[model samples]
Target: MLIDEMLHLFYPRVCTGCHSLLAPKERGICPECIASFDAFSDADAAGYAVKEVFRRNYPASNQPESAWTLYRFHKNDRLQRVVHAMKYEGVHRLGNVFGTLLAEMIAGSTAAAAFSCIVPVPLNRLKVVERTYNQSEVIARAVAGVLRKDVCTDLVVCKNHTRPQAGLSLRERHSNVKDAFTPSGNVVPENILLVDDVLTTGSTATAVMRALESAGARQISLATVVLAA
Candidate 1:
């Protein structure tokens, strides 16, 4: 505890959202910034959104059981600022903090408890290299820490690196990640919670979902740091 306090004294951390000094209890964003987040965080609503993404991918397939996100994504907003820190500004620990909080929302719920394993959406090799870490994996581990579940990183692998999904039309986004992911041959077919940093169009998430399903996953749930409209 003393070491931690000294470290904080030497390298104070700032909230990603407002660039304010983070208090001792805060990890990524401050309490005021957190309270300022737009509140569409209902689990039921997120579950519906998850099912909707599944339907878009496989209209006839069994829909996902639960989907949960902590905040609504708005361009140039607080959520976006935190996302930028995790994805671009090299503050990857923000994902860990948020993922733990994300899991806490549904901790004991049946839908959350049913998952046999947590799988982070695999990043392409190039992106992992550029980012220095897989933000999704960092998030997934934090969630696993809270949920007491195993995080399986190898269940899915990125097969191809494509153009960034940002600014792409829906169709273009889908095309970009089409065939971008493949499940490892040793899939367990267990109930799995797929974790990601953000769900924009969900093209990437849906593609990975298809791969997981193809690999014989029994049931799937979706969790993200934020739900992008």
Candidate 2:
């Protein structure tokens, strides 16, 4: 504890969202910035937006039993800043923090106690080299810690590099991610939760889901930190 305090004195913790110095109790983020996030409750408009994305994009036959996201991701907004920091600014621990919180939500939802394993949407080899880590895997591991489930990093692999899904039309996004992922090896679980940083058009998640299904996964659900609004 003394060493932590000493480190804080030299390099104080800062909120990923607002870049404000954090108090002692705060770790990666300050309370004010955390409170400012537009959380997605089941009744909220943004929550429904996520469902719409799945409805429009995910195949009916392969639809997940449940899905949940923590925040509404608006461009240039507080959530966007938080995501940017986690993805590009090397605030990697933010993924674990958000994932732990997401696990709490999942524990209370219809999807509670359903997953046997957590599978993060994998990054292609090139992107992994650039990012140095798959942000989704970081989140998935934290979630697994809370849920007591194993994180299957090798089950699904993103073999093909694709263009970024951002700024693309729904059709283009689908085309970009199609056949980009493949399931490898054995050890398929009966139920698994797919983890990702955000849900946009659902194209990427859908592709991942299809690969899991093809690999003999019987039940698959999804959890993410933000749903694009």
Candidate 3:
């Protein structure tokens, strides 16, 4: 703790959301910024926005058992800043912090216990090399830590690199990710939870889900930090 305090004196940890110096107890995001996020209410948990995204993009047969996202995302909001830091600023551990928070949100819910393992939406090899880490995998590891579940990273993978989905129309985004992923190994669990950073149009997640299903994954659900609104 003394060493940590000494480091803080020289380079204080700042809140990712607001860019303010974080209090000692805070991690990644300060309590005020966390509270200010547009979190999903209890009333919406049963019918989460991620569920709707899947329903609109994929058939009922392809949809997950359920899906949940932590916050509603807007282009220029504080939540976006947090996301930017996680994805681009090399704050890789922020993914784990958010995942732990996500686990707390669903601690006693039936959905949390339904999955046998966690599988992050994999990044293509090139992107992984470029970024030096897969943000989703970090998040999945953290979720597994909280839930005491295994994180399976070898089953599903992105075989082809695709263009960034940002600024594309939903249809174009779907086209971009189609057939971009493939399942490689033979020992895939029947029940798995797919973790990712954000849900925009649901196209990428849908594509990953299909790949997993084709490789003998019987049941798959999704959990993400934010849903684009």
TM-score per prediction, in order, is: 0.93, 0.93, 0.94
Model 2 has how many clashing residue pairs?
A: 0
lDDT of 3 by residue, 172-203 (tens): 99899988988886688889899999888889
lDDT of each: 0.82, 0.82, 0.83
| Model 1 per-residue lDDT tens digits across residues 53-144 | 66775575566667888887788887787787888777866887788888887695788778899999999999989878889999999999
Off by over 4 Å in 2: 42-49, 59-61
Q: Between candidates 1 and 3, name the one with more favorable TM-score.
A: 3
Q: What C-alpha lDDT, on a 0 to 100 scale, does residue 178 get in candidate 1?
A: 81
TM-score of 2: 0.93
Error of 3 at 122 (Å): 0.3
Candidate 1 off by > 4 Å? 53-62
User: Is candidate 2 or 3 superior in TM-score?
Assistant: 3
lDDT of the structure predicted as candidate 1: 0.82
Count of clashes, each model: 0, 0, 0
Which tens-of-lDDT digit does each residue in 1-229 have in candidate 2? 8888888899888777777888766767777777888886552344466667887776464776577788887678887878877886678878988999888877776665778889999999898888888899999999889988888988988888899888999999989998999888767887899999988888998899888898899988888888883
**Highest TM-score: which candidate?**
3
Task: Quote the lDDT for 162 in model 1.
Answer: 85
Worst 10 residues of 1 by lDDT: 56-65
